[model samples]
Every structure is written in C-alpha cells, then in structure tokens.
Target: MLVFFTFVILLALTVTNSKQTFVILKKSREDWILDGIGLFFQGIAIPFFQIAVVFQLYQLLLPDTRASLNLYPIAAFLLSFVFVDYLYYWNHRLFHTRKLWFIHQVHHTVTEMDVLGTSRNTLWTSFFIVYLWIHSLFIYLLQEPNWYILGISLSSALDLWRHSSFSPTVNSWLYRCLSPWLILPQDHAWHHSQFIQGNYGANLKLWDKIHKTYHKSDQVPDSLGINSSLSLSKKLFLPLE
Candidate 1:
C-alpha cells in the first residue's frame, strides 16, 4: 500500500517538475543528523508531558482500576484510535482556514519534501494533536487500559507518513480511486501547493471535501509553498495554515 501510493505521488511530483526538484533543496545536515535523536526524545516528550500534566490529574478522579474488568481495554483502544483520527479531521480542516492557517503555514514553508521534512516542524505544532486531549477525556471517562500507549503509536505512525516523500503506492488504481477517503501524496501535494485553497487537513480527505476546501487538478505543479520571503523551513513554526 505504501509503495503504490508513494509511487504515484512521486511520479506526479516529478512530472510537475520534469525532474525531482526537492532533491536539490538544501537544509542543514546537522538537522538531518539529529532527527533520530529528536524522534527518540519526542517519543518520550509528549507522553510524559501529557501524562504528567493531564492524565495524572485524570487518574485522581478515578476509582482503582488495577483490579477492574480488563476486557474493556481492547474496545477502548480501538475506539479511541478511531475517535482520535476523526477529530484530527476537524483539527486539520481548521488549520487550513484563515482562522488557523498562520500556525499551519509554518509547516508548508519548506520547499523541500523529504523524510526529514517530517521533523522540521516547530514544537508548538505538536499541540495541534491536542486531540490527544479527547483521547485523554475518553480514556479517563472509561479508565481503559493502554489507551495512552496506543495514542503514541498511532500518532507516531501518522506523523511519519506526513513527511515521507517517495512512497510508491500512489501509482495504483485502488489508491487513486480511494484517494477521497485516504490522504495520499496527491492530496498532500494539493495541501502543499502554491495556489490558494491547497492547504487543508492532512490525515483525512473527506473533511476537505465536506468543508469545500479540497483542491483537485488533472495536472500537478512544481512549487509547494506560499510565495513568501521567509525561509521555508522557518515557516513550519506553526501548525495552522
């Protein structure tokens, strides 16, 4: 699936450029070298940040769960994942609108699209996933097991895909046909395009369609950011836009 979607998207981007333009775009190698470290630290950061800050407060209101019926854990885990994805749809659409674009614009500023581009985002951008709060609320409300861990895993996987540039999956008919339901590179490219209305939600495709923010064209283009003067990498400072 990844290969099929990544290929079409990469092909679309290449045809748009007549060559792979992002290959020449330069960001500091120091930035590249530290990505794994960043990933590791961040792996620990948000959970600690949220658990220490939020979940601890949550557990205070709950009865003892160390001996409770654990069967609910699986249902809670699966349900929480879907709800998080669903709310991400709204949070993402909001970022595309004028009210939230400033934060999101920071991310699209990077003219270079690569795996490293995933980690180029600012710290506050992490808060955009504050939908984790929703996960927290449900987990606390239900006191399910391992909800927190599932949140971390699902979020990390989605974030990894957001910055992955060269997927070969987009070439398949199933990918294109299902593009409206899933966010493939074509949809992401539209969000990253220079033209107006390209910036929309990332994880879910239907939100853009329902909200009338979707951008579609038979021919793809070369440029990927707003025509701004600031360094593109600096633009990822905000999750809005």
Candidate 2:
C-alpha cells in the first residue's frame, strides 16, 4: 500500500510541481529518519496490539460460546467501518488535549503534507490509538473478523490518499461528488494547519459535521504545526517529561 501511494504521488509530482499542487515535493533526511523511527514503533505496536486483540477474542469465544451480536456478515463489516471511524473521531480529539498533545505533536511537526507524514506519530502513540486497541474487539463481537479487516484495510488505503498533496483535476465531476463524503487532501491539510482547528475526521466527514468540528473552506492554512521550544529529545520523551 505504501509503495503504491508513493508511485501515485511521484507520478502526480511529475505532472504538477509541489508549488501548484498540495503535494510536498521535498523532504529532509531528518524527516525520513523520524518517519523510520515512527514505522519501527508501529511495527512493534501492531503485533503487540494484535496479540491482545486475539487474546480478548479468545476469552470471548470459548469452546461453547457464541458472538454477542450476530448480524449478517455484510452488515457487520459495514458497521465495523463506522464503529472504528466513530472511535477514532473522539480519540483523535482527545489526543489534541494538553495531556496527550505532546505525544501527538511529533506528527504535526511536518510543515508539509505527504504520504509519509501520515506515519509520523510518536513511538507510543500508535500503541495507544483507540482504534488499534479496540477495533478488533468490535470485529470479533460482530462475528465479521475477515470482512472487518477487509473494510478497514480499504478504508486505510483511502486514508493514504488523504495525506497526499495531490488533488483531483478540477474538471473531474467525481471529485466534486465525493468531496463532501470523504476527507480530501485539502480538508485534511487543514487538520495539520498551524492556526486552524476542526476537520478532525479520518475517513468520513460525517462525525466532524455532526459534532460541529468540521472546517469547510477552500483556503489553505497559513502554516503547519505549533511553535515548540522543547529540544528534539525532550519532544520525543514528552510522555515521560
């Protein structure tokens, strides 16, 4: 999935330079190293969380046990997507609070938008992300583990597009139609905005609208990220600090 999006962004960059488009054309080596560390953390967190999810599911599904809710597989799959998105909506907002803000601030350090920026969270943030911790449990309870994985995988692929600097051609009618339902690149860019708030949904804009946290504007933000005085090491060890 990462390679595929990298190719798409490269192709888009060839057609439109970063200045005209939202795609960030250049990234520093330090940024790449930070992203690598983030990925390393993600690698560790994924297996650990998966183990916990499996253990929880095993406890729920003992020898003679049945699922708590047995909806049709298709319905369960669809509902899982909504459930995770809803979970993420609130959890993401919480991360912006004073307590969790420092941990999440690593990702926002990027002054530009790119696919790699999506992976740029702190070492522990991935582990504590609400969706990662609970989404699998919801999948098991719904009795749609396979379908749920597929749905979330598809949703995640779409999320990669949201982080890109690329935008659809103005002539494309499909872009206009789906712009409202899905989080487009520009909409998400504002979420990374230095001075702006709102636009906090991941895959769908429904929750943001319902919660009145949605920021609807075509204007790009003036800058990205907060001005921090902490040293790099201090920022990385923010949780402990």
Candidate 3:
C-alpha cells in the first residue's frame, strides 16, 4: 500500500513538473516497450516468483528452518534495512565492474530521470541482484516478518523515488533531513550519469561515503545515461559489451 501510494505520488509529480513531463514525452517507442516489460517483470513476475518458486525452494532446502528464527520487530526491520542494504550496496557496485558491466549496462541506458525506467535491465538481471536471494531467505527464516516486510516496502519506495525526477527542493527542510542520509533522486542521477562512476548505494549514502564513491553534488548532471548500440532484443536478452 505504501509503495503504491509512493508511486502514485511520484508519478503525479512527474506528470505535473514541466521538465519531468518533457522527459516523459521524449521517451521513444522502444523505451516504452523496454520499460513496460521491465515494470511488469519486476513488479508482478518477481514477487510471484519469490512467493511461489524461491520461497518454496527455500522450504525444500531448509525445511527445518521455515519461520524458525524469531526476532523483535525492530531487529527484523534493521536486518532488512541495514544489513541487507549494505549487502546490496556491494552487489550494485560490483555490477559496475568490467566483468559484470555488460549485464548491468541496459539499466544505465536511460537518457533521463523517469520512474518508468526504474526497472530497466536485462530480463535475467534480477538473478544477479542480492534482493532476490537475500530477501527471500530472510522472509523464510524469520518467524514474524511484518517489520521486515515494511523495511522492504520502504526500500522499494525509495528505489522508485530515486529513479524518478521527483526530488525535494534544495535547502528545504525535507531535503536537509533526507540528503544527509538517504539516497535522493539527484544523488541517483549521478549514478546514472554519463560518467556512471560513483554513488552506487540504493537506499542510503552511508555505504558510498564510507567507500569513497559518494559524489556530492547540488546539481543534476547535464548528460545522463550511456549511449547503447544494442537493439531492444539484445538489451532485454543477451546484452554483451
């Protein structure tokens, strides 16, 4: 519910903001096809797969540990928001490396900041992401995962927001509060910039700051995304450098 609400709000903001709306209007047919397919696969298929296949697979592999680890609500939340977040930070950074860049480059092909492009990636790229495995494993192991689920929801919401052009005004109270810790849209724009060198954390800037990959900037990059010669089919299936 929260994630949906967040998406609606962000979409509304994107449609209303002239600059963002222009970006949306400029989207090509191929962009729509890629993003639409990505959205359906990420939003629908991924969840269903997690519940039906991944969770069941975990049940078979760790039958004795199904919902066996009981934890306090706060502990479970922290486990997802902090521990898993840290793990994904490294996982995301690894995607930028030469060996894995081919699989991840499709996502960085977006030329502008738009929510629709949030999930843009090769179809099987989710398998390389830490969330698919770690999130399912934790949900299976934790006896009560409500708080953990909430954490996931919040993280997912942030992902949507950071991928869009919706951002708090600079120097505003909201910006001041969130910019110090959270990964804002502008922060993420740097990651998707033509350079694509730093700011790799998904939810928090702590990991990037700690690792010296955080690029502090008050302005969005003039140029965004990488130019890809790969066709839509190749991008969706086998994106080779």
Q: State the RMSD for candidate 3.
A: 1.4
lDDT of 1 by residue, 199-219 (tens): 355456666677777776533
Off by over 4 Å in 1: 1-25, 29-42, 60-78, 146-152, 169-180, 196-199, 217-220, 227-241
Model 2, 113: alpha-carbon shift in Å?
A: 1.0
Q: Between 1 and 3, whose lDDT is larger?
A: 3
Query: Candidate 2: where is the Cα deviation over 4 Å?
Result: 1-26, 43-48, 52-68, 235-237
Candidate 1, lDDT over the whole model = 0.56
Candidate 3 regions exceeding 4 Å error are: 239-241
Question: Model 2: how far is 87 from its true place, Å?
Answer: 1.3
Best-to-worst lDDT order: 3, 2, 1
lDDT values of the candidates?
0.56, 0.70, 0.92
Whole-model lDDT, candidate 2? 0.70
Who wins the lDDT comparison? Answer: 3
- Could you estimate the TM-score for every candidate? 0.65, 0.80, 0.97
Question: Candidate 1, 114: how far from true, in Å?
Answer: 1.6
- RMSD vs true structure, all candidates: 6.4, 3.7, 1.4
Over the stretch 118-196, how does candidate 2's per-residue lDDT look in tens digits? 6776566776687665665655455546677666666666666776667665447977887878888888889999876
lDDT minimum window of 10 residues, candidate 1: 232-241
- lDDT for model 3, on a 0 to 1 scale? 0.92
